[model samples]
Target: MGLLSGRRRPHAARRSIRALLAATLTAGLLAATGPAVWASERPAAARTEAAVAAPGDDWLRTEGNKIVDANGDEVWLTGANWFGFNATERVFHGLWSGNITDITKSMASRGINIVRVPISTQLLLEWKNGQAAVPSGVNAYANPEIAGKTSLEVFDHWLALCEQYGIKVMLDVHSAEADNSGHIHPVWWKGTITSEDFYTAWEWVTARYKSDDTLVAMDVKNEPHGTASTSPRAKWDGSTDQENFKHVCETAGKRMLAINPNLLVLCEGIEIYPKSGVSWTSTTPTDYHSTWWGGNLRGVRDHPVDLGTHNDQLVYSPHDYGPLVHQQPWFTGDWNRTTLERDVWDPNWLYLHKENKAPLLIGEWGGFLDGGPNEKWMTALRDLIVEHRIHQTFWCLNPNSGDTGGLLLGDWKSWDEEKYALLKPALWQHEGKFVSLDHQVPLGGVGSSTGISLSEVYDGPTDPEDTQAPTAPTALASTAKTSNSVSLSWTASTDNVRVAAYDVYRGTTKVNAALVTGTTYTDTGLSPSTAYSYTVRARDASGNVSAPSAALKVTTESSGTPSGAVKVRYKNNDASATDNAIRPSLQVVNTGSSAVKLDGVALRYYFTRDGSASVSAWCDYAAVDCAQVKLRVVPLTTAVSGADAYLEVTFAGGSLAAGGSTGDLQLRMSKADWSNFNEANDYSRTTSTAYTDAPAIPAYTGTALAWGTPPT
Candidate 1:
């Protein structure tokens, strides 16, 4: 929600300065004991001690634009955000799905060194007031001992577990209230919560964890964005205390550092009107609009916050969203990946890192791992991060984000392996180091004798004797055939090493990105009476591929009559926002005597509001609890200019029997789908089996319905 909307203001008034004269004096005293004195008069033991100052401390500090450890070695923040403590639940999501310990272990195993935990002021205050309670069924998978503990106690235990796992924590003050809607309200303090209360809450939270090194940083405010003209409570000026973000940060940051100077203070940018005429670079405009909350940083170039003595502790943080969230002007208009980075990314936040002004941390950025433009955007962003060595934490580790799902899928147990594959390359631990499929060799380049040699590294597996590929899958046959789906089973293949996975293919198209470990695959969304051919191939872990197995053909039963109907269903996830997308889930039913052939289905969506249409479809057969039907989603096409658009979903070999139905063909219509979409007025949908040749269906001809109403 912090990334969706808002603008933050700059500081106007300076607070009472508290100087740490003790530390300054200590540093001055150390400087007075010069190297000459140690070299000229020190004893042998003293000389040895002088030659090697105690190994750099483990505490982290900022020097220039880098985050350095006690040893003065640069440390990159490779982490993931686990949200939900800030939500209405006020507890981490998926505690019912898996144990928090296991989740933390999983993150650590993947080389994630830190985890950003978002929390709310209300929840913290609730804990402070001893009113925080862990409801029943909330900690089903958590430690048995923590079942009856308070929210704060559970959080303390989580921190202990994180420390045991060597993972650091950054507490994010996401909202004043523990609800998703609370994030959109520009200022951190709202409703009953006053500005003083907001500061007091931070002071209390920071004071409680000041002694713990596991809790490393504090993100001052999530995303502050609103205008004086629109929402007077959310304006930014260098002179006002009520709505000025800079002023708030200075006061809050000073208090936080006073409790723990080792803590890094993360400051985010405002979304809109970031200092009317300020620009980070000449190419960026003074009045440029930041697409998401806390994304705009142009104002920083002119009016950087003065965090007093704790200035070096500052890290410029920003949030970025891809086309999936909202298709901004930069996403369209003949802009390719290079142009996007050059025109949009560079000026926004990348310039900060490039110019070495401050260490830039991408606080939030992620999208569905589905292969499409979003994937391309992710790739481009990852490449830029790698190229610049920018520190970042993937947007989330939970599976419940409505806008962008997390790195895990279904029940929050399995990893989205595709996403992991895409992100693993950009991991800082592997940066500038040669990593083999088996293990990584630190400093493992040209002449580092301590590391694995290049010849030994690239010479394939150490087991040279096992060169045989797994035998091709055999006895493949359809276990069951439906009008629109076919379930297949086959004899497992044998390998000298081990059969890793089996590949299922319809004609030449591969259906799954991740490997199919079992000897079965269900191909759905088939055309009735269509003879579809499928083949299976086996592969081993050593990259050995087997020949395709004997192909099997199956034809779906025919529909006795040509009488079927299509209807649409929708759900308004966030009805509070005027610019929210309408997620439509379609259902195709067969009213025919027999099975009906359904090679493809076409859907036309009409909008009552005056806005352009944008669509995104979801269909993955391998996904757990996923849509049972498989579809090759075509890109959106606007038929009636911007008023309406149609998207075609083609099946590999799908059909529908009499009284059978295709469960849910899910699709998302962007907020831009209608410039003025009337929530009160119901949208209409028309569908047809004839995909390529189907004519544009008129709206209100069939059944028209609003969200929550049953589709007839």
Candidate 2:
């Protein structure tokens, strides 16, 4: 239930801190010096180290803001963005927890990354003991005590799954108001809260997850300026709300790092274009009230803001939902060929991408694609996403929508084939029963490589009359645990020449050969503690084996955890606070002082409440009755640093008014690998040491509130 359930990585300085601790441990066990410590005796660092050292890890480094895989391949993000994490005030890991993870894994198989997660400010507000503060219209059931335990639990689950499945995430702070952006538009914190609250929110986010690579960056605030990107008032003059949008973002970026040094902050642009913008005009566009930025800076003339003042992690993200708002007649009546370019494509691209040096992250873009140029237009937009290697998180993952912005069809259990076909080519598929060397397809560009497309299909033999014994399958599963012997089987094949023998392929490495009389064979002398998957094919004198059999999976037991490490750095890719985009990465290295075999890699993260009960979960204070309203109480305890790999939040169910708390963070190492007595020594760290601002035993009092129904 803890909010800190996701996974991520860190910078060199923070990595050094981990290494120093490890080094200290090594020094304490002088047994290393006594034996001259052969490589096998050394303790293993995590995935980050092995990635950085193996020459293979170089693929993780950035090339002009884009991430490259270990194979030196540039990865184009093709995925959907989901909101309601912090935005809806859903206790992340409570009822709504794991919903996003389920959605992400489904989308990733279809090739979608670049998720834009919209956050709500209510997650940050807090009340003192016996103080009443609650947003109206919130049901006690919706404001469950589980949420108060660790506001971060949801974020934790979201990021961990993104990392596990190989997808990137963008943390977007959607609205300053309890209600989504509009009306009191451009507000930073909900309910006219202090600017300091805004800064505090950023500080909490950046400091805690700075090391996690999957958590790419932060969108400081969503749609700060009103729809108009043109007027001076559209840009903050540091007058209207104590501080303007620009000041809030830049100042927050500075303050955040003071708490967490590696922070990437992205400031978004207003919906309206500046007067200098191509789309700018005294009147709003016929289609909508607000105008798109279209490359024009609304306040450039007055304040002369330059986003480069922040760190390299800065990025500019924009939201363009043409069909969502714009009236069709403005662009075309006939709705045929040429008009699509004139209105939607040409103008927006020029202003947003061409004029702005900052990289673009299309924060939100989706619309009905039943007919007209909608499909074609989306194709053009996707092409731009690929061409620029721009990170994109579609507007949503809602299955309730009629295929407009919905990427997955039914609660992530099924795919909207029509929509998925448009994006499937851009993703990596992890589920299938075949050994495929070709998971990638050529995206076509400078120094391009062909993507391999391998599949296991049941295609009947070309000729059945020609009698010839078939070839056996190549890949087979092992029957024994400790033995290297594996049982290989094949589906019979028909060929002109007599079937000779079957060759077993272990990864790209071939391990054994056997004569194919029947359909199965067992091969021995293979090494132990190895994971091997195989596919078999029958060979004729012509050396052509019937297509390899369906791939089967098997792995040998290992003596211990593989030795390696993975390092990650998070950065924003744009300049606008509204466009804030985060990108995380991994660098693996081997530091055992000797060669070691690496099996596989895994990463995880934990999100904890900010040392206080969640503001979103406040119950009644002075005028309140906790039991009547079903509000739970969270008392202050010890300051938490690092817990286990898995952070748990167990809340006493029911509505908790203002000052309530629940939950704890914990690391998730193998229970058998360590002991219960040693759990505190190995995992527990004072949370304040890493982030001094985070309180220990996050405790707070509830604000006054009217009693409500008990939670179901």
Candidate 3:
């Protein structure tokens, strides 16, 4: 049953009956098809954005090929599967190793909009019959948050957490019993658990949460598959409700919908299908088409699950895996996306989506990082999902998915960054930020750096379109600096409905291609020691933008070696308030044992050029003769917060030995008109008459630099 070997996968059903049983018994079968801000209330005036859990009417239904919210805005259910309630554990699998609350919050922050929780019919019936147990599977030390609760209570607590984080859930019937390897069975009903028990399980949970919309979906059953000549197998035909998957789906779907009409019912495909004119009575393997379990949907063309009054609630879900799970015939030789879609997927289940018969969700699709055919197959499926905007809950978030290693690594806390990067584009995102299913809270709760809410997506309710623009952001500041990036933060802007996102600007050009949904943004891909000015503007879903905020100036750190040979010092030569000329002196002192002798070493002083008068500079005095000193006045291409120009000073032929100083290299500057200049807010201005360390005056050495010159 381990995912490492294909022999134990679903394809074993294609072998001799004895081999098939061996594979089933040893196989841990699944997927070959499968599929914070706590309780704060909304403020009186929603105009001002607050990081709180607001309870908005969260109900969803389906249009032709899209799952829409109450306002009929298309929303994507991009998420992952967390299996455990269906297994012998009864609780989540990782609760033994990770904190349940932390795990839930982490998922929401990582753009998981919905969670497909695999559960067993036996477990639900147990809860109904008051057989709830404090699952011994959990390690209490790791999950102190729900240490004393029963498995049922833990699930309830998780639902509350989902509401707080703006995530949704879909209950999937993974198997008939609570056995660890129960998914290997071919039929929904096994042993004492009858098919009626399955229907009753869905009914009980549906009624329990009829008023709560967080549990918005119900997957009728896990993969149902069986080959010909296999008795007590799940069969699909355009006939009565014996073992026909279509009839069972219709029956269970109707029963669940009766309790709460807003729920989405997902129906999966079975194993083998009658080919062309072949009948179900045929026992010949060649007479039928065999695909991955729960992946053969050819029967949908003939016998579709009909929900008379609740047709909109039906969504056809199919599970597809890579070669590692079980390499079907089409996986060999030069296979590509075009071939796979046309040969395997088109006839199986993708047709339902292509023809707009119903909305499709690829309930399970993932595999190990084989870097071979498996990755190739996963890439093709991921591309299809992204191109068509198909809804999906990835195979798993757990790292223990045997054949298909999960999105999370073995540690459970650390994520498989590569796999997540591959899946990110398929998640529902707007303006570069992940989108949530809840209309009130954004994904990942309030103040999340990663997502926005459904109301932010479609401008709130349909009664009136959002027309009010968000308020201008305030208190913009650069919080952190790196050689190639700057992190910024500001107060949140308020909108009538919700602020969709924000736009960051450098000079006049928009630096961020997509709008930022959070209050913080780290602008990257910048040059070292570069001075940049930034501003921010708030935007609403209606495309209304607020006025720009006050600009903030930041200079990146130098990407160079440490300055050990010399240190630059400065002193204001004159502090006269009414002076027509400004004077300053800078001297490079050699601190290290080696002499500071290089043509590249220089010092720079920054100041604003007042009026249009041309400026002049000269070396007034130097320990070395003025002939060896050099000075230049340069105008800036972009004016920052307080300065627009800088004065550069350098020495040509002097070697300041260790513990020596280029003493008192004085300089002076003034406009041609002799206009008095104010240096109150100049970036390099200093009032201290005595010489001290001056980091403000950038100094440059041969291999090391400190803000003086632009990067080459």
lDDT of each: 0.58, 0.39, 0.75
Report the number of the highest-lDDT candidate. 3
Q: State the lDDT of candidate 3 residue by residue for 464-485, as single tens digits.
A: 3444456888899987565766
Tens digits of per-residue lDDT for model 2, 440-477: 11111111222111111101111324233344443354
Query: Candidate 2: misplaced stretches above 4 Å?
Result: 1-75, 89-101, 126-151, 180-184, 225-233, 236-244, 257-263, 274-290, 293-311, 328-330, 334-352, 401-405, 410-412, 425-712
Number of colliding residue pairs in model 2: 125
TM-score of each: 0.54, 0.45, 0.59
Question: Mind giving the per-residue lDDT tens digits that candidate 1 earns over 1-712?
Answer: 0100111111110000001211221222222121210012222223223221121112466765667554233556767899888888788878765777777667766656667888888888887777878744366545564566656766877765554444678888989888867778888887888788888888898877765666778888887775323454443446546777777878889888888787888988776543244432222332334446787676667567778898888988888878888876556533345545644676566666654568887888888865877888888888777655577778888888887888878667788888887887665442133221111111222233232211122222223454555688899998756455677999987652477667787887654322366888767556778899999877554334567899998986564312123333333333433455544445555444556555433334444333445434454322112433332222222212233323333343466667776665555544334343443444343222222211122211011110122111
Worst 10 residues of 2 by lDDT: 703-712
| Model 1 poorest 10 in a row by lDDT | 9-18
Reference-based lDDT, residue 514, model 1: 28
TM-score order of candidates, top first: 3, 1, 2
Clashing pairs counted in every model: 22, 125, 3
